[model samples]
Target: MWGIEAGSVAQDTASGQYAGLAPSIDSWFLSQSASTASVSKMTAAREAGAVPMVAWSPEGNLTEIKNGQKDAQIISMAKSLAAYGHPFYFRPFAEFNTNWETYSLGRSGNTPQALYGAWRRVFRIFRQYTGSKSLFVWTVGYSGSISPLKTAWPGSDYVNYVGIDAYDWCTSSSWCPGDQYRYKTMLGALRQFDGGRPAILAETATGLQTADKGKWLGAALRTAQADGIRALVWFDEIVPNSNQPDWRLASPSSAQASIQAALKQPNVASPKYRDITTLESYAVSASWAKAIR
Candidate 1:
């Protein structure tokens, strides 16, 4: 009754957790493998309307899944995966701006050019594979150290949705005078890239008690509505994982209630994710996104 990530999917299959969990994975992620047996299982799971989410470790050489590492490798693998007959979410190198261990920009001297090359090739391949809404997600760190858009921005044409990953980015340095600080910056950046496209908070954590999560979330909703951002993906740390600790850990019920309330507000738009097809038309021209200043 849950979406299985790569780490847990292995054991789940071995222990026959699939028997208990298969139904829950409906419309969510399920681990797929290079093996036909696993693929068949995944297919069966998906045929039931469950989304057998597959991870494309393109940046990781289709084996390692690095952050900003591969270009030709990603394109090549994308083709192979498409031929395989099962592609879900189509999500690849997610956290580029943030300094995550799995994948990051600063690694192997990842430059803007390298990122662009990889992005363009991936976009082209994905377009060729699925010509409609297939869902390709490009996620960013909510509190990116590299501002000045150019350093942080990637090809918008390849990205159907804009996702921001923010973890306790409310430190004195990261935050400004008050709520106005993060709100203005996030809204402005998202609006520029959005261009009428759907956007999501992607991953955010109000884990920290000091930060006024309620106020921050409320103001963000109001500002995004005014600016017209699409949706908000709350990063609640249900338990310890790769995303917790470093981000906001919501404690007070008020913080939880406030953020929940704001997101539920009907007037505000919901975050719209990208499918496999129609990425090109929805995405911003590489040239235009690079113009970020």
Candidate 2:
């Protein structure tokens, strides 16, 4: 299955353009604060025939969450998602290995033990309200401090999947100029840490370099299949980094043909409700509107 992290943009702007090339996308990845709007966005994804994979970042004091002070918000989110009544992926404080997140190790007195405890606390809260509807994903970034990746594991009981966010930032520096980083090369460490759980390419994109972006897309999908990566999500936005590559595929570019070809493979699953009629019936039901609200 293929998904997307649409960042801060409108859902249609991201999903619509990709759907134009691929028949469908299996999931829509969304990042959210502790906002009710997240629930609305999840509902919208279902209406568009795509499942939602939400990365919920509290973005506040990690000590508070670790100490159970934020149970109310976590409970509320779990309840809303449970009421939504469909299987969806939920990742809390994703990229715990990276200093960019407030919940990461070595940030504000946080350690691996603290991260583990905090994750278990959040996981327990979600279990109370969501039951099986919420699938917990433990996600990390590939290009960050490495030790936290091992220490932050919240045990197999709490996690249903392991995901890694990686990108091909080909540039003219000594690091990666025109580098065709194979999927396995970037994700090898994370994959080993997965411990037999399903792996997902939670977020990824390629920059324009000397390599053929189209061919690269095809190769990525092929490697993902060969490597037992169960899911993938493309990061479809152009947030600038030190390297000057526009990552957005919303417009026609050199990568379009390869993207289309890759997505059309028989192994790739398109986004469609498991049972659309049932979902529609539930939506019109009185309980549906009240639950989502």
Candidate 3:
């Protein structure tokens, strides 16, 4: 489905309302303290005809989670999600390979084993509640300096989808800092890691300051299609008090036009909340999806 991540559900809804094509999934972050509030947000999102994809991040370390210190909280969350009775996504510790996160490898004494164990512990708890329709998305950064992708994977049994969070920092400049500009190749690697599961661009966008953003977005969609990516979620908000570039499509009419045109195509999957059971159903063929949008 065509998804979007923003500061809040209302902000995402407003962006989509102005853009013509509304987002099918509203992606947002969550702390352990915000779990209950996330459930409320999910209800609102469901009523608004969108899925809530929560990036579940704990403020503490993964070692604590691995050791079952967070079991009580995890069980409570699992029960809440099961009661929601709608399909949503649960992405735990996204970009965990990066040092910026407390749960990441090499931080707070977290190892690859600790990350994997923590993920499995959470997954097992959620699975015990049979009514939950939450899909687990294992997301990785475009690049990792600490460990290889395989080292951090919690295994196929623990993962429902493979995802990558990447951005084109300088699509029009040859002198950009960092390696994320090579998102195409990075996405290719993500697909390989997917094995047979569906792949998603969990978060992505180009800087507004860059020229030819429309062209870049168009190309990115086409690349996603070719690489068999089931979904692409744009990171549509500008980060506050940070050097992160503005990725919103609300401005610069040309970029908006490009995405509106690209996303409206029949091949692109629209949100089918009811029939969305598996990857094949979610990633419908052009002939079947033509009437959806």
Best prediction by lDDT = 3
Q: Which ten residues in a row have the lowest lDDT in candidate 3?
A: 279-288
As for candidate 3, its clashing pairs are none
> TM-score for every candidate vs. truth?
0.54, 0.80, 0.85
Instruction: List where candidate 3 sits over 4 angstroms from the true fold.
Output: 130-132, 171-181, 188-194, 271-293
lDDT of 1 by residue, 1-293 (tens): 11223223343232122112221121222222221124454555444433343434353421233244454555555555465454444455565655652345666665545555555566676677654334565656556544534544455556666655554444342444343324346545656654544554444434445436556656655655465444343433344555444332234543545545544444432111222222122222211111111
How far is 153's C-alpha from truth in model 3 (Å)?
A: 1.9
Local accuracy of candidate 2 as per-residue lDDT tens digits, 8-75: 33553355455443212234433446544356666666666665677786545667778887777777
Kindly indicate the candidate among 1 and 2 with the higher lDDT: 2
Candidate 3's residue-wise lDDT over 1-293, tens digit each? 67788778888887776555567777898775654435677777766656778887644678899889888788877777777777788898898877788787888888888888899888888889733466888888876653366666777778888778888766344565433335566556655555666778899888745435655666677777677677778898888998877788764565667656656556554444233333224432211233243
Candidate numbers sorted by TM-score from highest down: 3, 2, 1
CA lDDT, every model vs. true structure: 0.43, 0.63, 0.70
**TM-score winner among the candidates?**
3
Candidates 2 and 3 compared: the better one by TM-score is 3
TM-score of candidate 3 to 2 decimals: 0.85
Pick the winner on TM-score between candidates 1 and 3: 3
State the weakest 10-residue window (summed lDDT) of model 2.
Answer: 284-293
